[model samples]
Target: MIESHNTKGLIFNVQYYSIHDGPGIRTTVFMKGCPLKCLWCQNPESQRLQREIFFELEKCTGCGICVQACSEGAIELFEGRSRTNRKKCSGTGRCAEVCPVEARKIMGRSVTAKEVFEEVARDALFYQRSGGGVTLSGGEPLAQPRFAVSVLKLCKDAGIHTTVDTCGYASWDTVQQVLSYADLVLYDFKHIDPAEHKRYTGVSNELILDNARKIYHELAIPMLARVPIIPTYNDSADNIKATTQFISSELGKNIKVHLLPYHRLGETKYERLEKMDLAVLIEPPAEEQMLALQEIVQSFGLEAVLGG
Candidate 1:
């Protein structure tokens, strides 16, 4: 949260009955904005601090509805999706206003906590039938610690299982507050090397590791460390060993470590934001390579989950 204010699930996306995020079927709330810019990010739309407009090039009929709706002339026709000059846009909610077909659209919307709980409550029966609840994911849920804590506490009050999928880059105090109401913490550790971590993700891992260590002192809840195995980034044999050794010695082997195979799911989102071109970036890791890495995790006496 760049600026903390009490908010509901900021960007709610109901992923019905999924077994992967956590125990049983779960609903994951996709929060927006992240401190890290991992090269293999799969949800690029959730990378901004505010609701941003993106062009659905395939859905556009060239109706020019967006152009007519732009109050600041921020949107204009381009090679494909409307060329959005985000530098000048005020986030006025105008360009996406008049688009009838949703060619011009926003990725996320702010929802009140009560309203969000109502949506989650819709699956209360499912949660009760099977031990599944809500999973708060990112961009980085801790980024909006206040609202996230509210929602997590609300879920705990309602007897809903709460899990936070975070990079663990926040302050230990905030992390402790959020974890107080969470039943599980899916912490992320991409690269352990501080220099290389900064080079790619734009942030050092020192704070992240510090928070994780401190949070583990009151480790009453279950936590799983998720590592996104990026080829040529943190996939080397030495990196895996260092990460596994650290987790084993610091967080303990009881805390599981999972391997998330990088994918191109959010490749199109980069084009929509016009942030930077990554088409020439490295490809996803091969399945065989993924299994090999999983074996390494097992070697460190930890169970390895293939993909998240």
Candidate 2:
């Protein structure tokens, strides 16, 4: 793919000085949009392509300020409780703009590549000092391939290291476009079996597995396959062994894998986003369980990391 000089991406967050995402202290750019609907997704807010409203019940004063501010009458106060009619709401952010307590927040915004690069450049000194740069994360950065590549190009021009944290579900062409600018890739490996993968993530694993191989072999991109260990979903010894075998034998190596233990940090977001029905909240595995899984990877003669 050719470089797009002025592509715009829908971004939700620009987190600075992060040590976990890449090689060193780095900034993580959270872009919006993803193909898979993983049951245990941590960033529920980043799943959609368009901007979304987050309603916090505790912060709401029930003053009806947002109700009046909403031109579409999407917000209403009932029994001193504020509710949003998601169907009526157009995500214009007008209600959020008028909310007194920030109870209503619009999550995503359209940002030009140049603008995003400027924000990342503010941390250039830290990147140089810590051998860290910028990490493109998301709902799957490859979902917005053009915008992703554009920002990556800016990072390349600035001599900053780039890492792409992806689900590896996009087309091979799209992967090639963005991989051109990425120095390291963080690939999410949810399940080895296609049936189990589709059961939890709502998509076939064929595309994802195929893309992983293309990244490692065909494209020759260095990538770390990370797994989110969900209890009863993918934490079994058999699952772990299967994943390690695939990473070690099929996927090109360094044979490095990161085990991301599931946590309930984003559980409340389900209610805020009114998506509890879609969420599969479960207790995280014990530290010992994680350690055991790590050892399983090591048993395969592959380097295993506890966290990403």
Residue-by-residue lDDT tens digits, candidate 1, 92-203: 7776777777766676788866666666777888888889999988788887777887777677788899888989887777887778878888889889889988988889
* Residue 231's lDDT in candidate 1: 87
Badly placed stretches (over 4 Å) of model 1 are 1-9, 79-81, 276-280
**Number of the top-ranking candidate, with TM-score as the measure:** 2
lDDT of 2 by residue, 1-308 (tens): 65566788899999987988989899999999999988888889999899889988888889998988889988888778798887887789998899889888898999998899999999899999899999999988999998999999999899999999998998888888889899999988899899999998899888988888888887787788889999988899999999889888898548588999998988888778867787775999999999999999999888999987
CA error at residue 59 for candidate 1, angstroms: 3.2
TM-score of each: 0.92, 0.97
What is the lDDT for 179 in model 2? 92
lDDT for residue 114 in candidate 1, whole number 0-100: 62
